[model samples]
Target: MGAMVYWVILSLSILALGVWVFWSVRGVRAYVRARGKRLVTCPETHCAAAVELDAKGASWKAFRGGNYFRLQDCSRWPERQDCAQDCLQEIETLGQGCLVRTIVAGWYSGKTCVYCRKPLDKVEEWTGHMPALLDPDQKTVMWGEVPPEKLPGVFENYKPVCWSCHIAETFRRVHPELVTDRPPRW
Candidate 1:
């Protein structure tokens, strides 16, 4: 009876271990399949490589010789946008001077604050402060302090502006139809 009980316990433990191993392997395989680059043949010269689509679906990168090359959806070489275009254009223009080629080519590297026209690098300078409009309406304003979480995007696109400028710019961008007249205060 003792021998039978010991054998049963050992068998159950082995079965549980086997199940755990199977589940773990399956999860890893699924993740790899979802994230792995798909193999493709270059249409230009029939060269084989691995390619992955970016979030925009318009851009793609092909991995070849341990390096990644940016290629558009049409499989052509990437080109810079117009010089007058905002943060993205400035970044592209400065690309010649930047030593980090990989980051320069990546997305969001060149976007700047809309108001100050400063590069995204200075985002930390103007976060967690009250906007000028809030100062006047402090008593009525429900939120006593600006939440830290909302600072990143706001600072990224509209830093260095006094509170009034920030509000004006934000309103202009988010509600162009409603704000026909520019705020005379700024």
Candidate 2:
């Protein structure tokens, strides 16, 4: 009888542990997916703002069955932060669409590098090779170098460059004396 009681208790414990683990994993996924630079229109100012969500806070709240989203950082901070976070509604509605990663990836899709004319693939952090953009004046720059609030305009005005060409162009621009012009061998 005692052995049967022990077995039942062990089964219950294992079941409880499994339930806990399931919730924890779901919460963590919610947190990770929500983490990223997001673009939203500020309700009060009616201007675009770059914002980061409070991922940790949302993760903790996820355990309670709903995510509690709040702004972790914003481009229009220190001056207009006190305003109600009506912008979160946009995130709640759009989900991953507002992420800068998603937006940039969409922009690069089906496009070739302006420099090498090679197809620009998805941005891969593991490969340590991120693509760049060529500004209107022909200067090469990374996306992070531009302010998030100005990304919309920049995206419209700039041209995409592959990782290899970006490095080559930057090197040539920085050391023009060392980089001699080569005639087309073709």
Candidate 3:
């Protein structure tokens, strides 16, 4: 009877450990997925705004099977931040679709460089191999050069340029005397 009771206690302890592991992993996944700069239209002002989620709070809530979220930062702050965060509803519904990375990736898809005519591939956000945007005045600028708040406007007005062209154009623009414009050999 003593041996049987000991085995039962050990089994219950293992089961409790398993449950804790499951819940912790679930919470971590929720944190990673929610941590990012999200673009959402402010329901109050009906305009585009950059917002970040309170990922730490969301993760903690996830452990209890709840998915609560609130604003950690916003572009419309200091003036209208105290207003109700109706934008979170958009984020909850859109999920990854509202992420800035997703929006930029969609813009770059199927696009060719305005300068060299090279087809743009995936924008490597992590690999440091990103394309650039050509402004209306023929200025070349990388995505990082644009602020998060201005991304929506930049996407609407700027044209995509492959990395190679961006580098060449930037060099030429900076040092015109060093670069001789040559007609295409073809």
Candidate 4:
């Protein structure tokens, strides 16, 4: 009789754990849906729009995956503020790394360092490594090992810079004049 009781208790505990996990996952999905910003398409007009979600708002819905969230009435959301369409179009046209490449190119292309106004050099000189920096998630080297045909958008224009320049520029963006006093050293 005691063995049966223990088995029943174990089964109930497992059931309770499963229910708790389900509820927790549901809550996370709801949160992601509310916080995530996504480009959504309108089915009626076949128009695309950027939808900003207020995670705390009443109309937010849980995305299929607990990793993200979406708006329940995306169309009803104001059109003027709906940048999702433009965002989506750009994403489709340029792919994920487009913006990053553009930014890096702009910085390298004679845009003086925020601190010293010195021209940034190509990455090969500073690091002695072919690729300067890599995309953390994609594991692709942004500077080296990129083929011309595979270059997305402006990434082909990417140039490598010495570590000193990169570090100084990063610091200047956050705290202007912080790294200016330091001499540029490779």
Q: Who wins the lDDT comparison?
A: 2
Better of 2 and 4 by lDDT: 2
Comparison by TM-score, 2 against 3, better one:
2
lDDT of 1 by residue, 106-143 (tens): 32245543345545433243355332212232221212
| Cand. 4 Cα-lDDT | 0.45
lDDT of 1: 0.37
TM-score of each: 0.24, 0.89, 0.83, 0.29
Q: State each candidate's clash count.
A: 1, 0, 0, 12
Give residue 79's lDDT in candidate 1 (0 to 100): 36
lDDT (10s digit) by residue, model 4, range 136-164:
33222334344322333334443344445
lDDT of each: 0.37, 0.87, 0.86, 0.45
Cα lDDT for residue 157, candidate 3: 90
RMSD of 3: 2.6
Best-to-worst lDDT order: 2, 3, 4, 1
- Most accurate candidate by TM-score: 2
lDDT of 3: 0.86
By TM-score rank, best first, the candidates go 2, 3, 4, 1
Global Cα RMSD, each model: 15.0, 2.1, 2.6, 12.0
Q: Which scores better on lDDT, 1 or 3?
A: 3
Which portions of model 2 miss their true places by more than 4 Å? 121-127
Cα lDDT tens digits for candidate 2, 123-151: 56415877889999999998879888888
Candidate 1 structure, TM-score to reference: 0.24
